[model samples]
Target chain A: MKKLLVLSAFAAMLASGTALADTSGKKIAFSNNYAGNSWRQAMLDSYGIVTKKAVEDKIVAAADVFTTADKEVPTQAAQVQNLILQGYDAIVINAASPDALNGAIKQACDAGIVVVSFDGIVTEPCAYRVVVDFKDMGKQEVEQMAKFQPKGGNLLEIRGLAGTSIDDAIHAGILEGVAAHPEFKIVGSVTGDWDQTTAQKAVATILPSLPDVVGIVDQGGDGYGAAQAFAAANKPRPTIIMGNRQDELKWWKEQKEKDGYKTWSASIAPGVSTLAFWVAQQVLDGRKDIPHDLLVPYLAFTQDDFEAALPKIKEGGVATHEYTQEEAIAAIKANIK
Target chain B: MTAIAPGTLPKSSPRGNAARARLLRGLLPALSLALVLIAIAWLNPRAISYFGFNLMLNLAIPIALATIAQMFVIAGNELDLSIGTFVGFVGCVTATWLRDAPLLGIAVLLGSIGAYALLGALIHLRNLPSIVVTLGMSFVWQGLAILILPKPGGKAPDWLLAIMSFKPPYVPFPIMAALIIAAVVHFGLMRTSYGVILRGSGGNAAALRRAGWSLLKTKIVLFALTGLFGVLSGMALIGITTSADANIGNGYTLLSIAGVILGGGEFVGGRVSPIGAVIGALTLALAASPLLTFMHIPPDWQVAANGAILIIVLAARVLISRRER
Candidate 1:
């Protein structure tokens, strides 16, 4: 009886291997670090929508999503190892830290799985990254500010979370952009923590002390709050270079209609996850020309663009530009060197 | 015969100098709060205004509530490491189910409090360390919070928001809320008849047991009170933020513990102050960010500076307390 049970177990393993080889469709999984924010929720939503369509179109066999709350690297590393053992064709990740997941990512690569990291990306050479050039986003924001204030004045730079790589990159890019215009003096800066309530309080506290600020440059997610702070303080509204959240866009649209306000906004859309999904799909479909690092562009909004996007936004929903599969493919094709 | 000797005071009279020292020690928390307030006002004159007080103390209500909750657990000689995450869990429930299905939400919250009571009973019966149990329960609460909300986008109830945003003519909302919390908690935990028995259980468990009071009952009551205040703290937090997240209340644990200690709460003694706890919470809220911001400290050093301020004030408290002994 023992010999028969061992022979049956071996036979079952062989049968499962044959079944896996026979399936034509590819299985993909998303290894998400933190699902505690609206941005992450939106990303997961887009993934759900796109993956559903992919499954219906017979482009993918199955898609699975796993999220960890603590944003700890070990939890995500263990998750990746589990995904590897489950025989996933590809894994897309929003890593907690850049270097902590390298070992697990290397293991996945050795298992012949395609790995795509986006948003908070991993730095492992084996992993393909899909992200916006945050530094350039910062530079473009300052340039847009320059358009509003041609003769530069005091620019209140509201930063994101302190000590974060994205914060450092964006601030560095803003300084680089301001280097050309010596008159654009940064009067004061505060970390808004990339949250609305925190930003509003920080701005409210600092507004009384700052000199007549002519413009504002903020890392996205705090523009609406900053505007509210200025209004609450009864100060004349400065040209707040907006981020692409729905609330900010709605406020911007209202200001344009009521006061003829003119300011540009730009953001990396949460739908970028869909792009990462398509890139993973492309790689799985034997696309060899994909680059290791793909820089997705931010959706830059002028007054007209905001006007167009305003009608599409639902109540309490974020304003996000959809990244189509064709555009994802074209971006991949364009960036190959 | 010794009474005939005049012009000399009794050196062993415990009521003379030690009484004054004890009074000073009792006033330490309030003194620290006043110093912080004065420093803030001197640095930024605008901080003295009614609007400034409202803004600076906007988030104090939740901290005060959480400190009161921690005080309950400390009253029973137990530390609740899970109170922070428990508040987060309650916040998530308030944002989602409490808004959608009011009855179900109420049931779930009551069930959680009951779970706390059961944990107390288990700790008493099994002779388990409360720190270990509560620390383990913290992850459980965190997981349950995530399961309920999944993300950070739930609107607080309109009524709660209204109450939190209430601006009286003379006093700010936070100050009013703090007064009410202090009064209610002080009455329930310090002045009531059964309160003495509950405190005695922590101060001297063996004696209380010998005196016909059940230790298990006191532990359950104390833990239940903690659950009750933790729920209030979470609801208050959501009311201020206008949204909910699983990790929003993560910082409350240490803040609550610090507030209790700053308010003259000891770990093993049933000595805690409801009024001083609120004041300590207010001091921490002010010193957490606004003080550093007013001082023009860089954001990178603000956390460290906040710790330094806490250490300084707490050291002063220690010195005064030592002198009293």
Candidate 2:
């Protein structure tokens, strides 16, 4: 019995000696709800790039990704259950709904699997959330607009998907920003659903009735569409806030070159999926100090630097940064307090 | 117009051939479901167990309910495009009003069913296209859903959550629920006499009218049943998800229609099977994601693969049905 105790003590000492927890044998699964957009496509790509390296280096055993074909809550809930059944050590998810998948997520947590959610993060208390401060992003949109448009005239608001938590957060932030800066009056608002075509169509439909608009504050992915709507209507272009998409940056650059048009671009990097993966890996490694909710900074670009970053973005993809394990650890440390 | 009653066999075909065709038609949906189940079991043997079924079929109850709702509309020779949005509206109510103010929620739901009856009456009295009317009503339901639950955060009632999570001994809740849904809807729409009249309205409205039956009443009854099932579907979905989103059931429009079609229902004719529809919903809910995941198909191809699976199963159904013709 003493010999067995000594052996166990030695094993414990060996584990502490390594500094980093041994997750080399652990298997991770990524359950992504939707991949229909460029942003989601880039997220998957970033995840694939990072996890493939992690696997080859033996940082983890297997990292498989499962994406639902449709954006249904039940579909994603079912997918999460399947991942639990698959015996994955950890699951990283981009949830379909904030509250809908709690039932499945609770079951996964009960089974002792580490679940990390990002972007469309879950509201389940057991799951770890890696989310961008979308509300802050919305406030910053107006703050940045104040820089370019000193005489804030009538502003139009283009919103994201109506029922999403992110949309509500951003919309609330924008309202707060507008309240702080009384110079800007939101004369018109329309739901863009965060798609360029949908935003363009929505804006075109509502622009005819509105008076002169000097600025447009929007959640990301709809800025370029707003610009196109103004152009198509032959109305004077407004200082539109851009989401960090290649086309939005390119359009901003063209407008800059033509007439010194300046606007701010910001979005949650699609590569946050990689950060989510690393968070799951860290939790599976038995890190105790990590918080359930981790707030990560959003990626933003100003007029001076957006042109330089424009070439780095793929033709139809959003600007994203893939995080390494070290960076993910640092982020976790930053969020600890 | 020559009207062929639902129960009495047509004079055109022999009794044996008709029986064979009827049997084949009845068996086609089950065949499709079995094929999917077998494929799933083959791909991942672990997915066949009780836990596997519990997890896999978790969403099938709501889908089966939604498919039954669509079936009700189709039984009246009318299409309901608004059912998906109506479900979303009902989900919002379930998550909010039903959880908070139970009586008000029940009243609202019953009133919504009355609204559906009114829509049916309007369509009948005005001789309007069901397609156009329901399509327009889809927007109305969506708007109402958004107004009720502007954001996707709501708590499911504890009782509902408990009922949904109930685990029966030796059988998963979802499978048990699917069986109950199938048996109940089949008995209501297939075995009963009034149900035959409802099916006949779709087969030959003119004949039913000539026979002294009120076509308006049948249409209203069918639509009201659609509303009832849609509410059940919405509540079931919320009971599973534990919350509500305004766009939650938006995909059900196509899914429910596909479920009915896959279950051997025709667009123009009053041909529908409640048991077959529940099976078809199960097949679709399985084929929609689980089969693709088990196959290890990459994310890029999963969407296309999903469409391909639908095509293959539906094509098989079509070929079998053609033999019946």
| lDDT, each prediction | 0.81, 0.90
Candidate 1 to truth, TM: 0.52
Clashing pairs in 1: none
* Model 1 stretches astray by more than 4 angstroms: A1-337, B1-15
Expressed as tens digits, the lDDT of each residue in B226-317 for candidate 1 is 99899999888777666676776777888899999888787887888888899988887776545655564432344467678878877888
Task: Extract clashing residue pairs from model 2.
Answer: none
Q: Encode model 2's per-residue lDDT on A1-337: one tens digit a residue.
A: 9999999999898457335548999999999878888999899999999999999989899999888878887778888887877778999999988887888899899989999999888989999999899999989988988888898889999999866788988999999998999999999999999899999999999999999999999988998999999999999988999999889999999889998998899999999999999999888777788899999999999978999999999999999999998899899989988
lDDT by residue (B169-203, candidate 2, tens digit) is: 99888999999999998998889999999999999
List, residue by residue over A1-337, the lDDT tens digit for candidate 1.
Answer: 9999999999897556433333247888888877666677778778878888778776688777766434544335545755665568999998865654665677689879999999878777888999788899998888888888998899998999764568888899899888967779899998898777789999999999999999989988888899999999999999998877778888998899998999998877888888898888878767677889998788778977788887776554556655666778778877876
For candidate 1, the lDDT comes to 0.81
Quality of candidate 1's docking, in CAPRI categories? Answer: incorrect
* Model 1: number of backbone collisions: 0
Which DockQ values do the candidates obtain, in the order shown?
0.02, 0.61
